[model samples]
Target: MPNSSPPVTTEAAPSEQPVIRWTEAGEERSALWRSERGAPPPKRVVLADDTTTADTAYRQACEGTALLWRGDFHNARQLLQALARRADNVPARKRKKAAQVVPVADAFHQHRLAQSQRARMLGMLLIPFNADYSIPLRRAPDVKTACTEAWGPADAAAGASVASLRELLGITSAHEWRRKGVEIAALGEPPHNRIHPHYGVFSPVRGEYIQLVATAHLPKPPPGQTSLMAFDVGTGTGVLSAVLARRGVRQIVATDQDPRALACARENLAQLGVADQVQVVQADLFPEGQASLVVCNPPWLPARPSSPIERAVYDEGGRMLQGFLKGLTAHLAPKGEGWLILSNLAEHLGLRSRAELLEAFERNGLRVISRIDAKPQHPKASDASDPLADARSREVTSLWRLAAIQ
Candidate 1:
C-alpha cells in the first residue's frame, strides 16, 4: 500500500481492527484481532486454543465477540465450520426484527456493514500450512488433495501458507467452479460452451452482459478496410472475445492487466477454437492501435477491495469505468462503437448518479448512440433476505452503444 492509496474501509482491514496480546505456550504473542468493521467493536477477546469447545466458539461469535486462535491450524478450520453451522441456524427470537423502511443509501450502507460483520466472523478461523501446503499438526486430515485441487500442482512449491478458513473455502469453491464451469449460452453449445476461470479471475456467471455483446449490432468495417476487427477491453476469461469471434468477427484482440486472467482467456479462446481469431495481450486498459468496436465490462462497485478476489468486483474510485470511457475514442476506428457494460446499482445506492455518468460521456467526447438493457437473473437478485434487495431488485444492467461526438 502506498501513501497515496486510500485507507482500507472494509471489515477485513487488519490495520484498523483491534489488537490482541497474550502469552501463548509461555511466549508473548501479539496479533490483530479480526472483527467486523462498521459494527460495535468486539466487547471480548479470548485466546482460544484447540481445547476450546465449538459451542463456546459459536456463542462468542453470536454475541458480537471475537476469538483469537493460538492453537493447531486444522482444529481452527473445524471450529470455523462449526461456527458457520451455528450462524446459519439463527434462533427464532433473535431472528425477528421489525421491517422498518430505510433510505436507499442508508440501507445499502447497513447491508455492507452486515456483510462485513459476517465475513469477519467467518474469517476468524484460520489455517496455516507449510511450504508444501502440508499441515504440521498431528491428527490433521490430509489437505494435500484439497490444496492441489484448488491451487494447481505448481502450488506444491509454495514456501509457506497462512490464510483464513474463509479464503480456503473460496479456493475450494473455485475448484468446483473450474470443474463445473459456468455455462454461457452465447458462447456456443453444451460440453464445450463454458469459460474455465482461474482462481483469481472474475467468473462470468452474470450472463446479461455476454448476451448484450452477442446480440448487439456490430459496426460496419471502414470502407477501405479488408475485414472486421474488434477489441475486448479487460477481458477476464476471453468470454466476450470468444463471443465476438463466434459471431463471425474476422479478428479480435483482448487486453487485461492480470496475468492469471490473460492465461485464462488464452486457454478459453483456444478451447473454443478461436485462439487464432482472438489475441490475448497483457495491458492495463487498452492495447496499442484501434479497432472497429471496443467492449469493456469494468467492476461495478466503486470501493476499496479487501482481497485480490474482490478486485474483480470493486473499481476503486471508478478508475476503470472512467478510464475506459475517456480512452474509448482514441482506440476506436472511424465510425467505431464502444460497448460499455454497466449496472445501475451504484446509482441506486447513491454512490454514483445517472447525471454523472452521462456527464462523463459528454466530457469524454462520446455520446450514447443507443442502449440495450437487461435485468440480472442471479440468485442474489431474488434473495429477499439480502439487506440490499431494494436496490438489487430495481437494478438494470445496460450496454450503452457509444460513438465519438461529431
Candidate 2:
C-alpha cells in the first residue's frame, strides 16, 4: 500500500506542531512533535521492543502503524535495518514486464519511488523524547550535545516528543558536518578554514562552480567607475559571494530565500572576512538594484523536489533560471554582464537541452558573450555504479558570460 501520510517539507511552516496520542497499557499518553521529513503521524501507534519480531514490525509498518520502539538502542537500530531490507523486497507487480526496456526517465522515476518507500519504511522506528531532546530509551547514548548543535538549545517546555531514530542520526551528522566543514580552495585560508554548513543549507563541495567564478574575467568597469559590483543569486553558504569578494568586487548583494541559508551565508562571509564587502539578504531572488556583474548558479535540474532540502538541487520548472534571465537586462548597468554557471547533467538525463537554454536567453533579450567550461571531478561523476551514471559521466559544467543584446 502507498504511504498514508505525506512527508513534511521543512520550508513550508507547519500550520501546527504535530502531536502523537496513543493508548499504552490501556492508558492514553501523548507527545508533541518535530519532524525529519517523513510521513505525518500514523493513525495508530503501538509500542515495540526487542520482542517485536522483524516480520511483525514490517507488517505493522506496511499497514501504516508507527512502532514506538522501547527496545535496547542497538536492537532498535537492527530492527530499522531489517525493516529496510523488507521494504526493498519488491513485489511481482513492480517488476519489469517481460521483454520491456524501461525508458531512462521512467527508470529515474522508479528509483525515486524506491528511495521514498525505503525512507518511509525505515522511519517507522520511532524514539520518544524529553522536552530537551533526549532519547528516553534504555541504552540510548547522549545526543544532547548533537541535538543542541543542530536545533539550538531546546526549550524547557518543548514537550514530550517522538521522532524517527533516522532523523536523530541525521541531526548528529549535520552537527559533525558543521564542526568539520568542507574546504573550499577558492577561499584562501588555512587547510582547516572551511564552509561549515548548517542543516538544510547546500554545501559547496563541487568546486567547479567556484573555480569558474574565481577565473571568469570580470566585465569592463562602467564609465567613471574604478570598482565593480556583483550579485550572487541563490547564494548557499555564500561561497560564490565570497569568491566574488575575493575577486575584488567592491560590493556584492548575496540573496537566498531560506532563512537557514541566509543565516548560513552570513556566518560564512563573516568567517571569510568578506562580511564588509557583501550584504546578505533574504529575498526570493534579486536584491534592490543594478550591478556591473550578476552571477547566478541556479540548480541545474528542472523537476519538483521531494522535500525542502532538495530545493537547493532542483529548480522546479527552472523558475530560478528563467527569473534570472528575465531580470538580467533590467538589472544590468550599461556594459554590465551576467555570469550563469550551470551543468549539462540534465541534458544527458533528457530533462533539458542546450538549445532550450540558449532560447531562454533569447526570450529574455540576453545573449551569451562568452562561456567557460569545467569537467566535474566529483566522485559521483566517475561512479559507474550510480543509478544516474549515464548522465553523470557526460556532465559538463559551464560558466556562460551573458549580456543584454544591443
Candidate 3:
C-alpha cells in the first residue's frame, strides 16, 4: 500500500483544517476533507463496502450519515446510481396526488429546492483520494489527471483527502468534456471549430445564442477609424470572441472576472487560431478603453447561484445585467452598438419583466436599435415532463442591439 498521507502545507495548520473521521479496523482514522461545493465535513461517518445494502446506505444517507466506501470502486458507483433511483422514485400515485399546478415562480423555486436536496443526499457517498489523487479501493480507475485538472495538483505534504463521489464523477466528466471539446458551428466545421472549456467554465452547450451573435451585423466604425474593434464582456470559453474573429473583426478584447474563464478563453482562442486577434483580460465587466462594439451575454436568471459553475447560469439580483447597462454609455465609442444577448425565460418565470428590462435600458440612456430572436433547440425545451417546461418552451434568446441616446 502506497503512502496516502496528505502533503503538508504552510497555508493552514493541520488543526485548523477540516477533517473527516471514521472508525475502521478497531481504530479511529481521519483524513483532510475536500468539497468543491463547500459541504462541511460530515458529522458522522461509517465505513461501507461491497456488502453494504443499498437500502441501508440510502437510509443512512438520508439521516445525514456519510458512507465512506471501502468496497470496489465500481460497486460504489453502482450504489450511487441506486441512491439516485431511490431518491427520484416517487410513486406514480403519490406524485399524481401531490401534483398541483403551481405558479411559474413557485414551480421554479420548488424545482430548485428538490435539486439542492437531491445533491446533498447523493453527496453523502464519500470517496477517499490518496495524496496523488488516486482512489485506494478495488477497481478504482486512475483519476489523477481529472482530479488535477479540477482541483489543481495534489498536495503531497497534505496527505490524503476525502470528497464526495458525486463531485469526483463530475470532475471526470468535465475532464472528458475538456479533452473532447464542444463543436461550434458558428466557428465553422469540426477540428478547428471546437471550444475546449476548462473545468468550472460554462460550456457552449446552447448554440442558439452563439448563432445569434454570429449572424448579427457588426457595428460600422466612425469615418476616422480604419478598422473595427469589439469588446466581449464576460467571455467564457471565448466562443463569442472566436465567432467575431471568424467574422473578420479586426481586433477583439475579451474580458472576464474569473481566472479560470480568462485562462479557458485564452486557450480556446489559441486553439481556434484566433489568439492573435483576441486579447483576453481580467476585468469586472469592461476593459479600460472603449470600443466601437461591446458585446455581453450575462447570466439570464436573476437569482443566487449555489455553486461556482452556477455563477455562469444565475446572476443574483441581476447584478451583471444592471452593471453592463449602467456602464454602457461610458464604454461605447461614437455610434458604437452594444450587443446585449439575453433570454426571456426570466420574464416567463416572473423573475424579471420585459418592461423592467426596457426601463433599465432607457434609464441607462440606451435604446434598443433592433432585436434578433431565436428559439432554443435544446432538448429541455421540448421535454414536456420538465417542471418548468412551460417557461422553457416559450423561451426566446435574443440579441438586443442597443445604441446610445443621441
Which number leads on TM-score? 3
Off by over 4 Å in 2: 1-15, 36-38, 88-100
RMSD of each: 7.2, 4.3, 3.9
The candidate that achieves the highest lDDT relative to the unseen native structure: 3
Instruction: Indicate the TM-score of model 2.
Output: 0.91
TM-score of each prediction: 0.81, 0.91, 0.95
lDDT by residue (tens digit), candidate 1, 278-379: 989999899999888999999998877766667778888999999999899999899999999999999988889999999999999999999999999999
Pitting candidate 1 against candidate 2, the one with the higher lDDT is 2
TM-score of 1: 0.81
* Tens-place lDDT digits, model 2, residues 1-406: 1122222222222547677766666566777656755457766777888788889889878867778877788888888888887886666776555115667667666667768777777777788878777787788988888887656788886677778888877877887888888888887777635888888787888999899999988887789989898889899889899888887887999999988898889988898888999999988788988999999999988887766778878888999999999888998989999999999988887788899998999999998898999999999999986778878998899999999999
Sort all candidates by lDDT, best to worst: 3, 2, 1
lDDT of 3 by residue, 1-406 (tens): 1112221221222675678877666566778888776677888777788888889889988988888888799999999999999999988985884487767787788788889989999998999999999999998999999999898888899899899999999999999999999989999987889998888999999999999999998888877988898999999889999999999997999999999899999999988888999999999999988899999999999988888899999999999999999998899999999999999999999899999999999999999999999999999999998988889999999999999999
101 Cα displacement, candidate 1 (Å): 3.6
Q: What is residue 274's positional error in candidate 1, in angstroms?
A: 1.1
Report the Cα lDDT for residue 188, model 2.
79
